[model samples]
Target: MTQNGFEKTGDDALDAAFAAARAARPQPSAALMAAIRADAAREAAAAPRAARPRPAPARASTRPWAGFWRALGGWPSAGTLAASLVLGIAIGGQQAVPLAGLDILAPASGPLDEAAVADLLPGIDAFLTEG
Candidate 1:
């Protein structure tokens, strides 16, 4: 009996046939191998060539303000900052009273009256009397 549980009939003809089949292994013909090689060669030739890597651009060494300009978020942001700075300076330099009409720095007509001081500090009168 064989390993696959096939009983050995002891047939010489069948045993010879199996031996011949195992010995004659199928292989690709030379014509098929030549055609495959031709196809591979054609595909490789038709494929696009790989591009060479380019060197990095050289940095500007002469311009010192280039870094500062870039840090300020380019031209639009720099222009805005400059305009804001100029407007702030112009407004701060003026002596005009603000919209609140309470300029502590402005000269007064005379000494502060009781009512005026009381208005400024609501609980000041009671604290002063207790003291």
Candidate 2:
């Protein structure tokens, strides 16, 4: 339809129905607009307000810790840094697993056996079998 990308139906029956409805719709009278404008004028004249000064713009912080805190960028980035540090400590200390079957899948690539996976994640078997 129109600019929304759907096809516009050009049926004569629907067009006649729409034309009838458009002719039947109620229209605003000139008296209503006159009354609305009077009410708006009355309210504006009744309310008296004091003149307020504009606030001064904020300046950047110059403290030593301010640069550090700004670099951290608040709690979301801080939490991300803490999570990355914990994961780094966990993965960094893990022992490397030795692969044996290097010719099964590819001539150079090693086999991904159970022992190899166990060496990578010790309790993976227990976790997988816990139904």
List TM-scores for all candidates, in order: 0.38, 0.31
Per-candidate local distance difference test: 0.77, 0.75
- Write one digit per residue (lDDT tens) for candidate 2, span 1-92: 53234343587687667667667998878999899999999987776653334566678778889888878897899999999999999998
**Per-residue C-alpha lDDT of model 1 across residues 33-81, encoded as one tens digit per residue:** 9999999999888776654345668866578888888788998998899
Lowest summed lDDT across 10 adjacent residues in model 1 is found at: 98-107
RMSD of 2: 22.1
Model 1 deviation from the true structure expressed as Cα RMSD, one decimal place: 10.7
lDDT of 1: 0.77
Best by lDDT: 1
Clashing pairs in 1: none
* Positional deviation of residue 75's Cα in model 2 after best superposition, in angstroms: 2.0
Give lDDT for model 2: 0.75
Q: Kindly provide the TM-score of model 1 when superposed on the true structure, using C-alpha atoms.
A: 0.38
Highest TM-score: which candidate? 1
lDDT of 1 at 59: 67
